[model samples]
Target: MASPLLRKPSLVHEGDATIVHQLLAQDTGLEYVGFKMIDLKVKARYEETLTDQECCIVALTGRITVSEGEHHFTGIGTRESVFEKKPTDSVFVSGGKQFLLEAVTNATVALCYAPSLQQLPTRWIKAGDVGVERRGKYQNQRMVHNILPDSDPSASSLLVVEVYTEGGHFSSYPPHKHDQDRLPEESFLEETYYHEVEPHTGFVFQRVYTDNRSLDETMSVEHRDVVLVPAGYHPVGVPDGYTSYYLNVMAGPKRIWKFHNDPDHEWILARQ
Candidate 1:
């Protein structure tokens, strides 16, 4: 069984405009990966110095000017909203550098991190450069956008991807788990799910469990919620009339993301 860990949206009025929500990390009981959401207004600036960890900044909405060392990216995102269904832009910077982002407009960004010493050159990933795939079928069908897939030679130990599911749909289906480092079957990876639901007020559901049913847990996931998957067969379901989106941040001893499906539910793949 798997015990799901969820963090609800931070309590802040619209007028207050939250700055950052630290979701998980070494200090917070997570060892490999860390996640956060950065919200800024026009001309607002945020800066951070990353040590011994590589980071990826994903724009959720609006545009921002990114400055890291001598590299600069202006207008980092073109999407007006997450529901735009358009591919968005993101930046990846190696550790031991300072990250500075100035909001060109009101914006929301996701920050993902993991330990690493290799200083890969920074890059601006265009929307079209991201590989996209329509996966599954029926209600389990979803779109997957690969950002920092393993094939990326510049990456050290981070794998980033985002999934979108239509309303009344299921994602991460068949209850897959990558808690073991056994190759050809599964490779251990620590992951974090940062969710954003269309309608903003709508919610989603997630089930994280293990084979023994000892750590089973189902959680009601609202907008801005973050779920930590230390080890489990995790799956998600979205309610009707509200689309679902989640950014996945992963890191592990091995950079590979091989996973194993629950044997009882693996047969569903044939139908898809």
Candidate 2:
């Protein structure tokens, strides 16, 4: 079950004094996934030492240099904003290591974290290096960028991905759920959505609910709003004339991303 903190979203704004805005803390009824958004001003920096969690530093805009132990990764971004419709770069660092980032230009970075004991080598994933799949059809059509997919065995529990939908289109459709431990058919997982809408003034709708109706919420979301999922079938929709983009951080007992679609919407997949 999700705590009240998980049910309510604490938005991080660019003008805020805090450099790091954490969406899920230890008290948020989450065991695996932890999320944060960091903004760095020119010549400014952010640093952390991950003793229990591994993380992926995904660039939302500008360029930054990431230092992990003896290795350094530079020029880690290009797009001016997520609305630019271009895939950005990301750097992954293992647990038990010191992570440092400095902004060469003003930048915003999404931090996806998951608890783990294993340590993987720090690696960079460029925009061109990620696979892009156009999913759904008509208004349901959207783009999916597979990052840290199950195909890679380096990380123990984190699964990262990004989704973008055109104006008036629906994404995260079919209302899928991975809250149970039913393997092969479904996997138990916790997820968090960090959102950004194009034109800055745009908005989206996200619904989190359980089958027995024990938990349910349909939220009106704006730029930089976050949604946390502890156990539920989640779906998202965007209004007309506005594009939608969200970075998803997921973790669970298993690294696989098998989900159960709502039975009512399961038939829609057959039509596609």
lDDT of each: 0.85, 0.82
Once superposed on the true structure, which residue ranges of model 1 sit more than 4 Å away at CA?
1-4, 11-17
> What TM-score do all the candidates reach, one by one?
0.93, 0.92
Instruction: Identify the candidate with maximal lDDT.
Output: 1
The number of residue pairs in model 2 that clash at the backbone is 0
What's model 2's overall lDDT? 0.82
In order of listing, the candidates' clash counts read 5, 0
Candidate 1 has its poorest 10 consecutive residues by lDDT at 11-20
lDDT score, residue 166, model 2? 83
Off by over 4 Å in 2: 1-17
Query: How far does residue 22 in candidate 1 sit from its true spot (Å)?
Result: 0.2
The digit string of per-residue lDDT tens for model 2 on 110-224 reads 8899877586888887778888889888778999888788787768888999899888877878888999898898999999888888877878888889999898888877788
Give every collision pair in model 2.
Answer: none
Worst 10 residues of 2 by lDDT: 1-10
